[model samples]
Every structure is written in C-alpha cells, then in structure tokens.
Target: MNDMTPRSFDGREYPYTPQDFAAVSAMVHAHSGICLPQTKTMLVYSRLAKLVRERGLRDFASYIDLIRRDPAERQRAIEAMTTNHTKFFREDHHFRQFERDVRPGLIERLDAGGKVRMWCAAASTGEEPYSLAMSLLGPDPVEGRVIAGADVAILGTDLSGAVLDVARRGHYPAALSQDVPLDLRQTWTRVSGGTMAVAPMLRDLVRYRRLNLLNAWPMRGRFDVIFCRNVMIYFDEPTRERLVQRLVDQLAPGGHLYIGHSERIGGEAARRLRAIGQTVYRKDAA
Candidate 1:
C-alpha cells in the first residue's frame, strides 16, 4: 500500500484514506489552530484508532462524522492530536536567563507590594510553569519556610484538559526530575519511590487552566514573563503571527517572552520585540 493507503493487512480495521486524513487534518486545524501535514498521517491514525474502536466504529469515516457532530468527542480528538512533549528545565539556558535577568525586577515589584505574573502558554503537564516557579523563588529559605512569600502568580494554560489534570497534580515519574537543577530539585520537589512530586511551594505559586489558543482568552492583566515555547511550530505562518501578536498584547511593558529556539519573530511582532538571548524577546519598558 502507498502512503495514503490504510495499513489494514487483514481488513479487520477501518480503512484510513487520504480523504479521511485530509478531513481529520482540517478539523484539527479549524478547532485548535494546529497544522497537521501529510507527514502526520500515521500519527493521526495511531492516535485516533483507539477512539474509533472504543466507539464501536469499524471505519474512520463514521468516526469522523461522529466527531463533527459531537462536541465532547471533538475535544477528545483534538486533545489526543496535541503533542505534549515536555520535561522539567527542558531548555536550561532559558531558565538561567530568567533567573539572571527577569526575576530581579519581578522580585523588586513583589517587594514593593506589587503583583507580578508569569504565563506558560503551553504548559504541558506543568513542568514549564513549575520550572518558572523554582527559578523565581530560588533555593533560599525564608523565615524557616522553604517557600518564600511573594505577590506572584504563574498561570499555566493548555488546550488539553487531560494534561491539565496532570499539571494540577504536579506529579511525575522520578526520572523526569533529572533535568531540574540539583538545588532546585532538592528544594522544590519531593521524590518517593518511582514518583516525583513538585513541592507544595511550587504548586502554591502555579495554577493551571484549559485554554484553546485559537479561542477567546479571558485573562485581563499583562504577564511579566510569557513562555509560549515549542507550540508555534504546529501552527501555520498566519496562525503563528497572530498568536505572537496576541502574546505581545498580553505582555507587560518591559516583560520577557520566550519562544521555541527554532521559531523566530516575524511581521509586527519583530518590530515590537527585541531579541536578547536565544529564542528570548523583551518588550520595551513604558
């Protein structure tokens, strides 16, 4: 069979045609702003095959029809299509830059009885936001408490409700904690058996919400630091440009924006943001 042909050797499963792939791809883009290329045909098939079987549907066509009519199933399909590959301190230098530059001003604001905010736009399973929390708070103890009191909030938002549940729990396999810095890991995380849990201090500073980037955002205030890394790669040029503009609009003056290393600022966002470090941009202070 060709690339477009379904891999049903025994004819026991549904035949996934090129048309089905195209339909699923378009539906994903329409609902989530994610661009699924032909290269992802097998990925789409593998991810949705279980759903089709669970629904007792023997064909991809019926599964597609059901999703088009059922909002809950549509959400599930989108969530399944989403790629949530993240780990603590995945980009170590970003966190280092954040601590060396971004945290000082935020700490100053907090000291002066001002509120500071951070947003992890693609906070898959909560590692990115939790990393931000650890970077902001550091290893120092305050008044015998490991968590230093501060007027700060880190908002972690993603389109996957299922991942949001994991983010809220702040638990992971113990092996995943390896990427975290030694001091930060010891201070901000707890390890028991094969499981690692983000310390209550880190959890206290972060909150998770299910938010579709293509949909309307209800947030009111600007963020001092926004981490929308590794997400724009899934979007087309127009979608990416619009999303960056929106991110800039929600960014506070003098705030920092960190994106995927492979992604670049374009169009209006290029003029609005200044590149300082690798994949990091800063908005001018008012």
Candidate 2:
C-alpha cells in the first residue's frame, strides 16, 4: 500500500475559519430556525460550496452576498440549509397522543359550538401537515376543518405554487405507507406508480402556506392544537422563549401544544403551560 494520504488535486485544503463558520451559522439561524453547531462548519462549507460553484461564485463570501441581495438566491440558500429530515408519522407517540388525549378533548369542545384549528409550524415537504390532516379528519372525512402548514422558505411558503408542485402531485415511496395502517392508507392516500398521494378530499381539508415564525405571524384566530414539533431546539434560549410565547398566544384556552422530545419550556413560562405527557403541553385555562 502507498504511504501517501489522499489530498485535493489542486493541493489547496479547504479553509474553514471560526469567523466564516459563525457567519454561515448566523445566516442559517436568521433565515431558518436551525442552529448550526461549531462541528458543522465542514458540512456548511461543503454543502454551500456546491452552490457557490454552480453559480460560478469565486468564494463563500461572494455567495453569501449574492444570496442576501437576490431574493431568488436567498430562497435557494434557505432551502439548502433548512433540515428536511421528516417522514410520515416520524414520532408515532405524538400522533397516538393526539388520537387518545387531544382529539377527544378537541371534539368535546367542538361539540360545544367550537371550531378546531391546527397549525403545523416548520412543515417540511408536507408530510407533517398531511399526516395531521389524515388524523384529524378521520376515515369518513368531512369538509370545513382548517389545517394550515407553514414554513419560512420559498419551498415551504409557496406550497400552493411551485413549491407544492411535487407535493400536490403527492408522490412518496411505497415504503412510506409502512407506518400508516391499511385502513388509513386506503382512506387517505392512493398509490400511483409505486408512490403515494394524499387523497383529494383529505388534501382539501389542509392548506399549505408560507410563514416565518420569527416575524409577525399574519394568522388570525386562535388554534385548538398547534403542532410546532421538532423546531424549537434550533433556537437559543431567548429565541425559544419568544417563539414559545407567540405560539402560546395563538393557542385557544385549554388548547394543546406539541414539541420535540428534546425540548422544554421552563420557569414561569412552564407554569403557564402544564405538562400533559412526554413532549406535550396544555395551556392553563386561567
């Protein structure tokens, strides 16, 4: 075996400085809620470098400038940096909790002349909201339930436009149906060319829109359940506190909030919200 180690053809190693890493990390946090760790410097450089090369930019700094100045370029960068690691019912327990605990409570309130509204914040590529749609509407399915999925990125915001072109088509691998029960799979989705699409009836119950959680939320009306799951972990404590409070504001009295398993809202803020179970919170009626 040769003693020489592998090296770049140009003999110039990639330069990843502390400042350079901080700049990109800050940009990511500003645009999306994702917090890039210091260890992810290499990942940021490697992934974004491809964009720089594709756009014929000379370096990372130039690419950042271009993205900041150009709306379309910024959108591409937002899509690139935002984590899209979601699958159908990724956290099964949450869905189960929705069915067993939350849904019944919601239905009781709805029966007493109330309406149910749900927001899926950080909805990536449509799986989370679509899953919620299926669960809330149930098998028989009725109209008029309001389910909204929102994201800050163009790919997420324009979900009704070019962003949803693929999602509207509703194609996922057959393996995705593995978690969904046969009855629900048959009721909510249909297979075409070994892919799955949410049924039109169920799709009509949910609407996808562009929303930036960091900015003023344009939404009107309080919600019975807000599925802001797997998102708050990206923010620093202050940001998290602010976002959590905003989410709580939108929640109707006695409403429910679902977050990622790894996150928590503590102290006085935690007092306003009572823990229902693992990763679930109920807003105090008072």
Candidate 3:
C-alpha cells in the first residue's frame, strides 16, 4: 500500500497497483469466503507471486486477468493462498472435554445399536480426525468392545483438495506426533523412515472428503459433535455467521460444536448455541 509495505518481492519491483491488490482480495473473498485484509498485501504477493511466474505473466494485473478467464486456475489460486497449519490433538483441552464428558454419552448411543458420528470440518492433513478417531474408539485395537471396537464413524472435510490428498495418505513427520499422547501415539502410529503412518484401524474409522464450507454440502443426517475450528478466522463476520448456522443445522440436538479457540458466533446463530467450554458450544436440545 505504501513504500514501507512490501509492494515488491524477491528481486523484482512489484508492478501491481493498490487497485490490483484490492481486486485480487475481493475475488478471493467472493470465491472462498476468506477475507484478506489490506495488511495481508504481502501475504497475497508471497503466495501468488510464484503462480505469476509459472504462468509466464509479467505482473499481478495480468495474473488477475488470467484467473478471471480460467476456473481451474482460479481454484488453483485458492489452494495456493489458503493457510493450512494443523496438528494432532490440536486444542488439547477440547479433546480432554470430549474424552471425559462427551465420549460417555456417545458410548450410550453405541450401546443402543447406534453409531457415534463425529465430523472434523477442516481435517487438514489428517491429524485432527485421526486424533478424534483414537479418542472415539480408544487406543487399543479390540474389535468389539466399549470403544476400541465400538460402532463409531468420523467424516473429515476441507476445502483444499491438496491437503486432502495428504490426509488420505495418513502419514506425518514423527515430530508432529508429539501432540498425541504416548500410549495413543504408539498404538495408532507405525514409525518408519522418520514419518508416522496412522494404523489401519484408526484410518478405517474416518472418511476424508473435499468440502467447501461456503458451498453446498452433500452430507445427510446430523453429527454428535462437529469440529469447525480455526478455519473461520480468515472469514469476515457475515461469512462466519452463515457458515456457523449451516454447521448448526448439521448438528444433532444437544450436540457439541467446536470452533477455533479465538473464533465466535453472533446474532441468531449465537442464540441457538450456549457456551459449554472454551470455543465449544452446545446446541439447545429443543
């Protein structure tokens, strides 16, 4: 925006004008619901600059024109710009709450010939859903018991197909496994070549699918608990509220919804849910 701000990058002087930045930001928000503030000018430049080069474009203005013309390229641009940082058992306190208060009730349903349904709304690279799988169906691999073999299912979805590719592979660097408890880690991960592969049992418990939070969801029925965490921080309030309401509709009565620790719901969406814990809310059973 100004001389001090990063208008240029690498070795080249940034040729795009402020109007160019604004247009790109507006297009991204309209397509993905992620609000890129003017402060993120550098971020936008950093993420898309390579694409400009790859496209053989001379400047950001030309790059924007190409994205306008090509739907596939636009999708690729969205993938390139998205921020995907997640870990196993991230927001540990929420997992603690689930293991204690939530699991017991869901166990009751399992005992009644029902299945425990959990959805990781943004299953970045597979960690969150796998951690949830371990928590839902215990660490041990007993095939027909209270948990280790209980009737449970998890659905993991994210807007980014590239990250979803990583998710389906079910592997992560060993260092990233630290957030997982020792027993669960040992039970669920097979270590080799310095990366941990999630055990078949755990992987089998969850299904990974590509989902755009701002687009139509093909899912049916409701979930006992839904984790739609830090993904909303990039969205403006109106977009956030709309997404929250849709998530609420997919939640079973009295089911829990987990958002990012720093994210919140407002207006009618806020009224339908009551705070149960940090960034966790319970839908009114009525």
The 0-to-1 C-alpha lDDT of every candidate, in the order given, reads 0.89, 0.69, 0.85
Residue clash pairs of candidate 1: none
| TM-score comparison, 1 vs 3, better candidate | 1
Superposed by TM-score, candidate 1 places the C-alpha of residue 90 at a distance from the truth, in angstroms, of: 1.0
TM-score to native of every candidate shown: 0.94, 0.83, 0.92
Cα lDDT tens digits, model 3, 26-95, are 9999999988899988888878888887886768898999999999899989888898999899989989
By TM-score, who's the top model here?
1
Among all windows of 10 consecutive residues in model 2, the one with the lowest summed lDDT is 147-156
Give the per-residue lDDT digits (tens) of candidate 1, residues 1-286.
3355344555535678899999999999999999999999989988999899789776899999999999999999999999999988888899999989878787777778889889999999998999888888887656215225757789999999999899999999999888889988888888999999988877878888899998999999999999999999999999999999999999999999999988989999889899999999999887
- Candidate 3 stretches with Cα past 4 Å from truth are 1-14, 143-151
**What ordering of candidates by TM-score runs from best to worst?**
1, 3, 2
- Best lDDT among the predictions, by candidate number: 1
Q: What TM-score does candidate 2 get on C-alpha atoms?
A: 0.83
lDDT of 2 at 277: 84
lDDT of 1: 0.89
lDDT of model number 3:
0.85
Better structure of 1 and 2 per TM-score: 1
